[model samples]
Target: MSAQDYAEISTLMQAYADGLYHADSKALRQVFHPRLAYVCATPGDELHLDLETYTARIDKRTPPSETGDARDDRVLEIKLATPQLAHVTASMALMGRTYLDLLTLQRTPEGWRIVTKVFSYVPMEKS
Candidate 1:
């Protein structure tokens, strides 16, 4: 990613982490589209979440404590195609395990926003 792209991705990723940590729907709404798509693979199963489902779920979440479960150390490695479309992968440690969230973003008139995301942990094989 170019410096400009990197800067944009960093800002957006921070917004994502903040949204989850603070459980702020407005913040989340700024980073993602209302029609966003998501896939999360946890130990139990591979789950899919659409826009409305994710909105409802996020709306119901309790924000993490100030000092705990505040996701940090996000690293975004991005490859951009025309600066409008890019693939980004970021990692952070939440709870006791390291999780990676891969995001696909497309620049819209509003700005660069995530369109789809896949959330999963670093599998145990690496641990």
Candidate 2:
């Protein structure tokens, strides 16, 4: 992958972290594809949500930003299968949980956008 593509995707992931941290659905719309798929299949608590539904849920949550919570968002890895597609592994903290997200992104006409997100989370044990 070109350096530019890596940097762009890196920035996009950062935006994702910020979006969730602030619960800003408007900001999320800029990075996520309109028809993106969100899935979580952690056994009995499986979840499947489309882009609009996911964003709507974000809109309804109280933001960590408002709660003064520490933001622990990171991009663990990024792999580009082709010039137009990429896969990212990332982690973020939200609502007392740590989520690991496997994201698929596409280079759309409007630039890179997240097309799918398959994720899982676990409770953040108290230290």
Per-candidate TM-score against the hidden true structure: 0.82, 0.96
Tens digit of per-residue lDDT, candidate 1, span 1-127: 6788878878888888777677777888899966788898877868898877887787887666444663565665877877689888888765555778888989989988999988887533334
* Maximum-lDDT candidate: 2
lDDT of each: 0.78, 0.91
- Of candidate 2, the 10-residue stretch with the lowest lDDT total is 40-49
State the lDDT of candidate 2 residue by residue for 35-62, as single tens digits: 9999995667799999889988998999
* Clash-forming residue pairs, model 2: none
- In angstroms, how far off is 27's CA in candidate 1? 0.4
TM-score of 1: 0.82
lDDT at residue 7 of model 2 (Cα atoms): 88
| Residue 41 displacement in candidate 1 (angstroms) | 2.3
Error of 2 at 4 (Å): 0.7
How many collisions per candidate?
Answer: 0, 0
